[model samples]
Target: MIFIRKSNDRGRSQTKWLSSFHTFSFAGYYDPKFIEFGHLRVINEDTVQPGFGFEKHPHSNMEIISYVVEGSLEHRDSIGNGSVIKPGELQIMTAGTGIEHSEFNHSQMDLLHFLQIWIVPEKTNLTPSYQQITINKVLNQFVLIGSQNKQDGTVIIHQDVNLYVAFLTRNISIDYSLKANRKGWLQLVKGKIKLNNQTLLVGDGAAIQNEKINLQCIEDSELLFFDLSSN
Candidate 1:
């Protein structure tokens, strides 16, 4: 089954410096029907104005992932990990126990665009940690960016999930099969694409279960695919 979460239907939070669209319940956005998809908790598409960003905040027992779409993201956390994430890079912060973090736009002249994802951990109270990796997306091919076991040098997350990304050009197509009892979530980062005959535009998402995903690019696009446990 394929259930779509349309771009226009997502909840929005806008401030003088920030604009965020939530795919699930988050902060001040709540939709009972879209609370979550399996263990995938939050998917926030955010844009920050020049010289502005998020200040220190705390989180616990959640696997937080960051993917920058444009500009540079400066991240600093209580765990002594600090870095600048540019386009084509991925960062993960395991907020086990608890942690305080801040994210800002490194470029004072360009708007910062990114996605913030949260996944519930399989177990709680583990030590907090952070990791960042450079990922080069290949056309029409799945690139493993995060997984339970750090597959293909991807960052490790404390959950039964695998995150993949791909960049596609017009007319390209790809296929992925889900194992029995597994679940899938697809997020369209940029441009348009057709997922199993259903079209998705920027900021759109789809939930899948017990199905094979067929994707065809309607234009140049970037996307994220998640393979998750049924639980």
Candidate 2:
């Protein structure tokens, strides 16, 4: 089965320096019916002004993943990790017991656009951790950004989930064979595409609980996919 989440139906909030959309229940936008999907908890599309960003905040028992779509994001955490994530970079933070971190735009003239994802960890109180990977080497194929084992340069998380990113030009297509008993979610970060015969535009998403999925690029597109188990 495949369920589509239209881009326009998501919760939206706009501030003078920030614009965001929530795919699941987050912050002040609460919807019981859309609280979560399996272990996938939060999917937030955020754009920050050149000089603005999220202040230092605390998190616990959740795996946070950040994907930069445009511009750059400056990150600093209590774990002694500090870096600037430019376009095509992935950052993952595991707030096992607890952790404090802050994200900033860092750029004086360019706005920062990125996605923040939260997934429920399989076990709590493990340990707080941070890692970032650059994807400049894998621009054409789907690159593993986050996984349980930290393989393929991906940051290790506490759950049995895999996150992948792909940059596809027009007419490019790929088929992903879903593992037995596993589910998938595809989010179109930019441009247009077709997933299992369903057309998806930017900010659109599809939850596929089926056996397989076929993704075809209708235009230049950047996409994110999550393969998760139904725990």
What tens digits encode model 2's per-residue C-alpha lDDT throughout 67-96? 888999999999899999988678889999
Prediction 2 TM-score vs. true: 0.96
Candidate 2 clashing pairs, residues 3+ apart or interchain? none
With candidate 2 superimposed using the best TM-score fit, by how many Å does residue 154's alpha carbon deviate from the native? 1.5
**In model 1, which runs have C-alpha deviations exceeding 4 angstroms?**
none
Best by lDDT: 1
Candidate 1's error at 180, in angstroms? Answer: 0.5
- By TM-score, who's the top model here? 1
Instruction: List ranges where model 2 is wrong by over 4 Å.
Output: 136-140
- Residue 227 in candidate 2, Cα distance off native in Å: 0.4
Candidate 2's clash total is 0
lDDT score of residue 217 within candidate 2: 88
